[model samples]
Target: MTLRADAVGHAFDGEPVFSNVSLAVDPGEVVAVIGPSGAGKTTLLRFLALFERPDEGTVSFDGTDVWDAPESDRLGLRRRVGIVFQEAGLFDADVARNVEYGLRVRRPWSERLGDELAGLLGRNGTNGAVREALDLVGLADDADRSAASLSGGEAQRVSFARAVAYEPDVLLLDEPTSDLDPRNTAVIEDAVDRACDRGIGAVLATHDMNQARRVADRVAVLLDGGVIEVGPAERVFGSPDDERARKFVAGELVY
Candidate 1:
């Protein structure tokens, strides 16, 4: 599936945050959104995720307009998309439960009941899925640990695991590694690679040009609330078509 945002625009209190933004994420491809702070990267991601409807333009999944769809259809579409915010946003629960939360809530009632029964009988009880997700983030052994007891990086990994556990068609990440150190950043990057290998389309909003180079198949540069350049990662970073994009890439531009 492909997620496309066509000429999206948004404003707050009569002030435009961004305008005429457009991009797309194709299945199995990773598109990195790189921009300075307050450049509307998060806003663009929100529109793509269907969490917010742009005041102008449309977000379409496989040519179906998300905003025009019914609530149930929208919800269904949302279920197929996973998002990890800037913060971990974990609940006060153990790692396994936190990771299992999305699956439990999104599964059909009968399926949920079956999993609950399996839990009561002491069978795998969704632990298999939970463990697999935790493993993906290098936290398999921390499944029983409390989320509150983990480090900042660990917490973020758990948050990522929770998103990954859903096996979504699309993954949206907003500065997931911003607060992480080098090692944790690598771990998160590896998880993203794994997701893409599984054919899940991803849109990552990050300020780190190097990370964009490593993870993105294509790069979209946002400046002053609009995408100034978008193309193959190497081309966009090495020889951007827009003068502003060139400046931004050369570290000559600052937000």
Candidate 2:
């Protein structure tokens, strides 16, 4: 799916966070939003996810204006968009349940599909898709484990699996690697690449330029509440045209 933000702007209590911000995520593309802390990266992602309304612009998904769509259509549209938060956001349930959470939310009887679901659950009785999703994220072996028992890395993997299990057209990730070690970070990054391979467009909001360089096809640098520069990842990081972009790349504080 394509996510297009046309001059989107939002604020809280009259304090402007950003204005006239435009962004787009095309099929099979991963666009990274890099900025300093408190630069409105999360806010932008929230707007894209329809969790927040833009006070001064529009957010469109797959050629449909989300803000203008009917309630039923909006609900359907939301089902096709997935958001991976900074934290794993898993419940107290087991690993399998966590991975299949989104599917259960969308289609309560999804387990009635076939043996694949049963296999995921370690038996042919039922509840197998949960296990399959966990397996997809390398957490299959932990299907019976509790969410609270997982390490930060493992929990994040479960979160990724859950988001993808629903097969959303667009994935909005906010600081996806913030709480993981390098190894786990790499695991999640690879999953993200695989998501794009499956024709899911992604918008990742991150504070790490190195991670952006490693995963992003294009990068948009947000400074002082607006997009200062956007282009190929290499050019944005290696040869920025704007001074703000250059300073951000050089490790100086832009805020």
Which numbered prediction scores highest in TM-score against the true structure? 1
Query: Model 1, range 81-153, lDDT digits (tens) per residue?
Result: 8899989999998999899987766553345566566567452467788899999999999988999999999
For residues 32-117, could you state the per-residue lDDT of candidate 2 as single tens digits? Answer: 99998888999999888888689999999867899899988887777878889999889999877777668767544444555566
How displaced is residue 90 in candidate 1, in Å?
1.1
Kindly give the stretch of ten consecutive residues in candidate 2 with the minimal lDDT sum. 118-127
Clashes of each: 0, 2
Name the lDDT of candidate 1: 0.89
Give each prediction's root-mean-square deviation over alpha carbons.
Answer: 2.0, 3.4
Candidate 1 segments exceeding 4 Å error: 108-124
